[model samples]
Target: MKDVYITRISKFLPNAPVGNDEMESILGQINGKPSRAKRVVLRNNGIKERYYAINSQGEITHTNAELTKEAITKLFDDSFTQNNMELLCCGTSSPDQLLPSHAVMVHGLLANKNLEVNSASGICCAGMSSLKFGFLSVKSENSNNAVCTGSERSSTRMMASMFNEEAESLSSLEDQPIIAFKKEFLRWMLSDGAGAMLLENKKNETGLSLKIDWMEAYSFAYELETCMYSGGEKQEDGSIKPWTEYSSKQWLEDSIFSVKQDVKILEEHVISKGVESLEMVFEKYSKDPSDIDYFLPHISSNYFAEKLKTGIKEKGLKIPESSWFTNLSSVGNVGSASIYLMLEELVHSGRLKKGDKILLSVPESGRFSYAYAHLTVC
Candidate 1:
């Protein structure tokens, strides 16, 4: 099969950067008292700033479709938006709606701009799995050119609406703030962002391209279990409440992108799986640790930094501190949009030179999935 190259990548963050202090002010306090969730999350996650698609009143200002539209438009240069755009693959942790798929909605927006893509596909919550789909599409010759996007707009609305002191009445826990923060800490760590990459088959174009050397993905769900999940907990019979049977209040409690996670499982397994997967991918491509010129990682929390560094070294791959670059501390974890955003920052920073190899890792607690991609600048 011919190699796939990422010809161009464009990343976007809605509104301005929301600093930790400012975000705390916006989230306000729960139960009319000082809540330490925001402060502690900022300290532990190392997320100093993030973007939110919110209005002046701090309400959700952009839907998933609107965010996707802004991202697609920002990256759509006339030179690349030719009729050759054969496939569109959209990936996100949240969608504007369940029916009609987010990819189709993006396609509709593209069509309005006269950018007609023939086939559209998506994985609603697989994170980097969605971009891998587009990569495979072009590499497998199913499409000559493709566009893949990872967009997210999850914010504090859901977290505040469902976990406030009033809502805590539903729970029998004593420390409501701590319990609520534990359940939906993602509200602070996750922010709004969209990133898109244009992929094409081997070509002698005038644009820059990152040649794909090899890519691999794995799931450690067996060991990780459901560390992170959406929706309400399942009942005794293992059935979720149907939407039709939901009261407006119950609906808000269940349907939001408000995440439920097991912190112990995530901290224990995220880095181990990442190192194991990187080892396998490196061996598969005959790549040694010394050969990697750059390291791009999408980490879930800043708390895992030391563990990731030590764990990977323990596994025999040593990444230099200078070669490591990530936007997590500044942009926060935009979920699936993270890897592309990190790559975009690195690329535009003029740090990479020709022939330099980039080793990228994306770890997701959703089903505890991890993926590695080895790329070379052409």
Candidate 2:
């Protein structure tokens, strides 16, 4: 067994930025209004702009495979086309289809591009899971070199008319119960992007950018109880039902094929239970929040910033607000890619000094899971 070092990271964003006001033209009028729900969602989440895998016409432009390919391409050296990677791990909130995994699809595209990688590709739970998978594989000597990717095309595949759509005969969007509850909240929180990182067992001669120190993860699924989820449906026999079986109209009405979250539950769970789990991680690593030089967290809402700060203080750790860095306010919540995007922003800022220790926390509401890790610049 050997330790892992993340040597290189690359990322990609689709098309241009989509501003808050511009969404009305793409999503059309909702509840007989020009996407007032979008405006409200922005107010709640504090998202300025997000990238979509679509043009102004709202047509599908890039698939999950393409989004990931862009980042993966930047990771490898052009002259070194033959893959040195022994494993390919992909984490995606929205895969192009339900059949083949997104990792395998990306593998196929790599072959077409004359970039041959013969490693097995496997899909894991999105968010920190894919990155951790790479770390473990290299640590266990399963692969000397591995590439991990996280991508999200959540916006492009969303069910049509996802928000308030006021028919001349129907009720206004505000008056619609389900729209006011589910659709409005999630519509603005997500963006499309992809991030990839290359991990190796051996450190470079110049030394790696970040040497993996410690990694840990935990789940509070029982306490959260479906705080956030997206997928098809469940039948009476507890069997899974295909999302396509339902009409697009039913998708919105039933809250199917969408991210449904209870905000109060999610927030409470994160602040209370989430922090408790995080503290255990700190104890496991024998490090305090003050020992960390940089703190990067992937949070969907800016509102949680203070809550997390308060929680850290209560745990007897004294991390400063100025030490925090993230791209969420600008890039929006990029699902599984958020953690990688935040790390990318930090490394590119040129503020990091030698021996600086950084801590990253990525919490995915998919099942109330959290992963925290410590890394140091060499």
Candidate 3:
């Protein structure tokens, strides 16, 4: 197979940056009361401001497809446009509707002639999955070029209205006046944005391009239960009861459709599994961690930053703090869009030089999966 390169990267963050204090105002209060977990979650996530598709009035300014379109549009210029794009791959955790696939909706928004479209569905690693599809397609000579996008219009899901029914139901029972931390904690953590990248068989002639050295993903679902999820409830047996299994009334009462995380599972498995996955990838490729010039990790919260460092170091990959790059503090956790956003910023930061090696790591708490990629500056 031939080599592939990322020729261009772009991102779109909807609306103005909403500060920590402005989140509750934009998302509104659940049960007409402020979130008890908001402050704690925000403090741990270390996000000062984040973008949201929802305006202050709670009106949605853009859907997930629209966000993906906007970012993809930014990838083109007079020399390259939608007419030249041969393949499109979109990934996301939050799509506007359940019926149409997210990539088709984005293709509809772009109004481009039909070519090939694929959608990768999951949490954060979904973005990397799309990138991998594009890279492999170009590498195998199946496509001349591919446009890959990762986006989330999650603000709509995080709105107070989504949880008000469940919170009210809990209040009525009086056994618990608030929703569980598993359901409410994510409200403060996730934001909205979209990012797109162009992949081609040849590197750019005039500017820098990221040569795709390798990309690999691993899943431990057989060895672990779900740790983060939405549109489902975690049962006592550690299995998920899908949204379809619940009645509409039950959906509203239990917030079965709201995003939730089994924090205990997350705390116990995420870092350790991530380290093990990375070690396997490194061994497979005979890669040495000390050769990395930049390390970009999609960490959901700053709380895990040091823990991830310790875990990886114990495994012999000791990337220093100065070599690390992340925009999470400013952009918040955009889920599937995060790694794309971080890569976009780094590519445009004017810091890359020839022969530089960049390492990307995205750990998905959704059933404990991880994706790692190595790129070289050309």
Candidate 4:
């Protein structure tokens, strides 16, 4: 087997940065009333600005595939272009359509020659899953190089129109009605963006490259219920009733297709389960947490940043706050693309040095899944 390295990284955030006060103007108000939870959500998430693929007029400027293609295009120069790509892997929780795979859609936009393509579907961890696939492919010598992408066009689904039906339905039963906090809260939390990375067996000659030391993933679905999801409803028994099981009209009335989260479950288990997974990975790989120079964690909200540090410290992993880095406050939460975006920024930040060790952590609340990876600067 051969070693794998991330040779290049790029990201694309659509349109201009939308400020905190501008979100309602862009997404519009549900039932002609501004969200009551918007201020609190934005404050807790600590996101002052974010990008949206949709304009103030609610016109879509780019699709998920288009965003992915734009990020991938930025990865190439005169020396490396689409013609040189051998394998393509795309991961996203949001896709333009449900028929064709996301990778094929991105490939169609690139208009490149035929190559091995794969798509990974899930929530935040989807990006890391794509990276894992590319890492293994290059490590096993099955592919000389691979282009991996993670993106999300979440604005299309977060529009107020998507939930108007549900808001109206609830209004009929009560004097003053608002959509559930679980669904309304995410509107202010998510944004639109795409990120891409190039993985190869050899490190870059001129600039810094991230050598993939190891990757690990774990799922607690058997012990936990779904916490964050879309196109389905969580039953009282902790099982999900898929969108297909609901009537067409019920889908709109309940906003069944819109993303929702069990905030209570997320707050209780997200950090604890992540620490458990990190412990397992450290034990299996004989990794020492104190050796990490930088720790990049994909946190959906800033509220959990300190909580994660506390939880991990209790487990004997003592990564200090100064060593932690994140761009969530500036870019907002991009779901599956967040880790990629964070990594892209760090790679270009001019802070890395030879022999530096970076640790990545991505926790997906979609049935409680976690992915961790270690990289070394070379």
Candidate 5:
């Protein structure tokens, strides 16, 4: 059993910004009162605030495929090109369209780099899945220089009139409490953003930085159809339209079962490779949870964060303030790019040193959990 290492990482976000109080205020106004909006405002999204790209009208700005291109360009220039890279991959949900797919477009944007570029799109977990593929690419002799970027233009997906109309209508009636709760939750929780990263096979001078270990990715085909977005229908305006509805309650329910199964699979496989228990995985691979120094969590809300915390406790792990990056409190959910954003902070801050192991975890999306080892502090 060999391990794959991550050489470099990077992230990108839209220019707009939003916070919890602002969200609360908006919902309060829409719902007609602060008291009325309380339940919707107090979920466990781990995000106290988040950013959104907006236009001159101050409405949420849509994710521009061009912006994603710019972010990836920046990442390559600033993060990994110097490693003498050979491959590129982009993880995203906001594609140029349903046909060519985002990856192929991004690959072309890089001027047909001749390196294999995968623009992968599969909801939230596409980011992690892309990385897993990149690692396997490196380990299996498919490619050595790999860069992965995960970005989303969720703002583009907002169904404003539909949302507001539904919100207002639901506010007026109490017919189906469950349905009402689900709709409201999705409206308030989903957000718009993007993030990117650069990876390479070459070890730097000191050789003490982040390294990838092992990645096991699985998707339950049975649950595939359970979550999806229908193709846009042709409109009288001669344009296609996407379904704006998001099933949050369905998503949450499906996620719990998916994550449990995925994690169980990863635990069983990795443990057999000598990475037993939460403690052994940390200690043998790098450091103990107690001495981990910091925890950069991929949390979307408080409810999600508490769920992760419970998972940590169940595994007998301890978390410290330094070990956690709570940006979700401000960034809503950046989807695929969440962990990379946190990793970028750790590196830029110079807090991470060569030889210090940073344990990274992703509990959602693909209903998967993976821990990677960043081996050095450079």
Candidate 6:
């Protein structure tokens, strides 16, 4: 197997910041009670605070295409850009356009516009998926550097209709109508942020101890058509609306089902590679789960983490409390970019060491419940 190491990584949070308390306050102001907002604030999502982009008046901010450009440019400035960037991929949910992809916009913003750039638009899973693709591209070619950026401006879609949808699904009322004449609309949790990672075939001796040794992804029960996306809107007075309408609960169900199937496929593939279960796989590699300095679990929330923990324990794997890192308390779920952000945070804090194995688990889309586990240490 060839080695693909991450040389540099960068993340961006816009000027606007929102914390759990702040969210509670915002929800209270709109919904008439702080407790009513608790469902989205303190429960399913393990996030307490998030950042957003703001305009001149100082209202709660939304996503911006320009910010994405700014963040990408900054990432390139920090990372080594000696030659033309052969590949540029943007993984984002809050895109400026649905058809053209955010990748082209990001690529156009580059100091080296002459470089080839593209967007890997998928759901939240697109971030790591793009990274996987970018890593493969770098490994197979002479191209020394390629960039992957995940940026989102979530506020664009946040509306009362969406909140009503979330309120209904997360409501305590079990008897709530499954079928409503007027479907409750929901504004997705819109957090404004961006993350960029520069991958190359080089290694830094003094950087974080984390590295990528092996990575494999399995896609099963993949269905693009079954997936529903809001295409556009129906305006009231014959005018056009900006956002589309989709079922969040349905999205969750589909992703969960797909993830379960995909995990089975992953376990089979890993076992066929001569490693079985979490313990056997670690042991075969001559490393103990206990030896792992940090465990970066995907930030799906306490519910999701609890499920993953149950699975890990059932497999007889041991990871120390100190080894586990989570940012859910600070940043809600950044989707595909969450685990990567956790890894970057660990490295930037001067905690990463040489030969220290860091695990990367990425859950693709809402449907592909898959994780990419790699043991890479400097």
On lDDT, the candidate that comes out on top is 4
lDDT of 5 by residue, 1-378 (tens): 234556555555666466656654332333343334335545544456666665435565444455556666665544445245566667765565767767767666657346666766665667777777777787676676577766776554443333444444554667432223323344455555555555556565554456674444334433321222323322445333443333544333222111111223333332222122345556554555676655665554566555556566666667564566556665667766766676766677766665565656544433233434333344
lDDT of 2 by residue, 144-263 (tens): 877888888878544346543323224544454334445457776788999888888876666447888878888776654655656655444534466678887766566566666667
Candidate 2 TM-score to native: 0.87
What would you estimate as the lDDT of candidate 1? 0.71
- For candidate 5, the 10 contiguous residues with the lowest summed lDDT are 254-263
Instruction: List the candidates ranked by TM-score, beginning with the highest.
Output: 4, 3, 1, 2, 6, 5
The 10 consecutive residues of candidate 6 with the worst lDDT sum are 253-262
**lDDT to native, each model:** 0.71, 0.73, 0.92, 0.93, 0.53, 0.55
State the lDDT of candidate 4 residue by residue for 137-226, as single tens digits.
Answer: 999999999999999999989999999899899999998988999898899999999999999999999989999999999999999989
Between candidates 1 and 4, which one is better according to lDDT? 4
Runs of candidate 3 exceeding 4 Å displacement:
none
lDDT of 1 by residue, 279-377 (tens): 877778777788778988888677888888989889888777667878888898888888888998887887766788898888877556777788999
Model 2, position 28: C-alpha lDDT score: 55
True lDDT of residue 183, candidate 2: 47
Candidates sorted by lDDT, descending order? 4, 3, 2, 1, 6, 5
Each candidate structure's count of clashing pairs: 0, 1, 0, 0, 37, 15
TM-score of 5: 0.69
Can you tell me which runs of candidate 4 are displaced by over 4 Å? none
C-alpha lDDT of candidate 3 relative to the true structure: 0.92
Which stretches in model 6 have alpha-carbon errors above 4 Å?
24-37, 55-64, 77-79, 82-84, 161-190, 205-210, 220-291, 373-375
User: What's the alpha carbon RMSD for model 6?
Assistant: 8.2
Residue pairs clashing, model 3: none
Candidates 3 and 6: which is better by TM-score? 3
lDDT of 1 at 60: 70
